[model samples]
Target: MRKIIWLASYPKSGNTWMRVLLTNYLRNSATPVDINKLEGGPIASARLWFDEWVGVEAAELDDNVIERLRPGVYRCMAGETHDTLYMKVHDAWGRTDRGEALFPADVTAGVVYIVRNPLDMAMSCAHHWGVDIDTAAESMCDPTFATSRSLGGLSDQLRQSMLSWSGHVQSWLDESGLPVHVVRYEDLLAAPAATFGGVVRFCGLPFDAARVGKAVAFSDFSELQRQEREKGFRERSLRAPGSFFRRGQAGAWREELPPELVNRLIAAHGEMMKRFGYTTHQGGNDNVD
Candidate 1:
C-alpha cells in the first residue's frame, strides 16, 4: 500500500493553494479544475472519518478520548487507501495524553510542510476566525490554542491543537520522523516554478516543466478569487467578513497590521521568525535581542 503524505501547515498558511496546484497538475485537464471539485484529499481532523473508523460517534466522546483514538484512525485510513494519500493537517506534531503520537509514524510516508509569515498569517487568521487581529495574534501565542474545542454542539472537524504558532512549526519540523519538504509561502509566491518544482520532486513525481507552469497558472490567486466570487467557496468560513481568497499577497501585514501588534507577534515568535528570514521593523533584531 502507498504511504500517506501529509500536506501540513498552520491555518491560513497556503495549504489550500498547494492543494489547488496539485489537483491541477495531477488532473492535467483541458479546463482548470473546479475550485469546489478539486480532489484535495481528506482533512486530518474530520469527525466523520473518526466516527466511521472508530465505530462510535466522535461527538459523544470527550476530547481526550478522541485524541487517544486519532493514531488508530489514521492507521486505518492509511491501510485502506491503495494510492498515496495526501491528507491535510493543522494539528501540531505532538503526543496525546497517553504519550501516543497524534500522527502515527508507521503510516506516514513524508510531509510537505507549508509555512507563511506570522504577520500576514495574523491578518488572514483574524479574518478566517472572525476575530480582531489582536485576538488572533494572542491566540497564535497561546500554548493551549485549539480549533473545534467547543462542547456546545458538534463540529464537522475534530479538535485540532495548534499549540502556538512557534510551537506548531517547531513540532512538525522537529519531531515528524518521516522525511519533510519545507515550503515557504513567500518562496512559492516569488518563484513558483522553482519552488513548486522542488515540491513535485520531493513527492517523487515525474518532472515536466510545462506541466508545472500550467499548474501554477491554473491555480493563480486571481483565478481562485474569481471562482470564489462567482460560485462561492465552500471552504470559506461563514464567519469570514469577505471572500476566503481575499488579498492573497505576501507581506500584507505591513499595511494590515499596526506597528504595536506587529511588534507583539515578533516578540512572541521572534526566534522562529528570524530562522525563517522574517525580520522585525526594530532593526532586524528580535525583542529578545
Candidate 2:
C-alpha cells in the first residue's frame, strides 16, 4: 500500500514549479510538458473529488462536515491507488474541531514543505489575488486566512486554511508529525538541480543526474512563462491580473516593496524567516541578507 507524498507550501511558494519539474522529469520528453495537462498530482482540495469519495455533493454538506470527511477522502485515495500519490496542499497542517488530523499520517508517505521569504511572497500573492501589496501582506499575517471560502457560491475546491504565513510554515514543519524535507524557494531558484534533486530523492524516486538536469531546464521560468503566454496556466487564480509565471525572480521586493512593508513582514515572520534564511534583502540573487 503506497502512501501520499505531499507537496506542501504556502501560496505562491513554488508548488507549481515543483510540479512542473516532476512532470517533466517523469515524462523525459524532448518537448516541454504541457502546463494544463500537469499530472504530477491532484490538489488535495478538489471539490469534485470530495463529491466522488463521499458519494454526495460537497455543496450539500456543511464546511465542518466536509473538513471531517477530508481524511476519509485521502484514505480512500490511498486504498485505490497502487502507486504513490503525490498531492499538492496549501492548507496548514491541523486538526479539526473533532480533534482529527486533517491529513492522516497513516496514509501519508512524507512531506516536502516549501518555504519562501514572506517579504517577496507578499508582492506575488498580491498580484495573484488581485489585491494591493498591503492587503496581501495583511492576509499573510492573519491566522484565519484561507482560500475559496465563499459560502455564497461554490468554488471548485473546498476552503483551504492557510493560517498565517508564519503559522503555515510552523504547522507543517514543527506541528505535523510527518517526515519532512524542507526546501526554500530561494534555493530552488538559485540551485534548482540540487534542490529539485533533493525533492525527487525524498519522494523515494530513483535519481539520475541527467534526468533531473533535463527536468530543471524544461521547468525553467522562461519556458513556463512562454507556455503561459501561448495558451494559459489553468491553475492560475481567476483574480490574477497577469500571467501566473509573470516575473519568477526572487528578490523583486527590494525594488518593488516599500521599506515599511518590508519591515512589517519581517516583524511578523522574523523567527521563521531567520530559520529559513529569509532574514535579509541585500545578500545573493534571492537577497537573503
lDDT of 2 at 275: 83
Clashes counted in candidate 1 amount to 0
Query: Which residue window of length 10 is worst by lDDT in model 1?
Result: 280-289
- Per-residue lDDT of model 1, residues 232-281, tens digit only: 99878878899899888887776788888887887788788878888744
By lDDT, the best candidate is 2
Put down candidate 2 lDDT per residue, 40-156, tens digits, no spaces.
557998887888889988787777888999998999999888888889999999998899999999999899998888887899999999999999999999999998863643688
Q: lDDT at 50 for candidate 2?
A: 84
Candidate lDDT scores, in order, read 0.86, 0.87
Candidate 1 colliding pairs: none
TM-score of each: 0.95, 0.95
State the local distance difference test value for candidate 2: 0.87
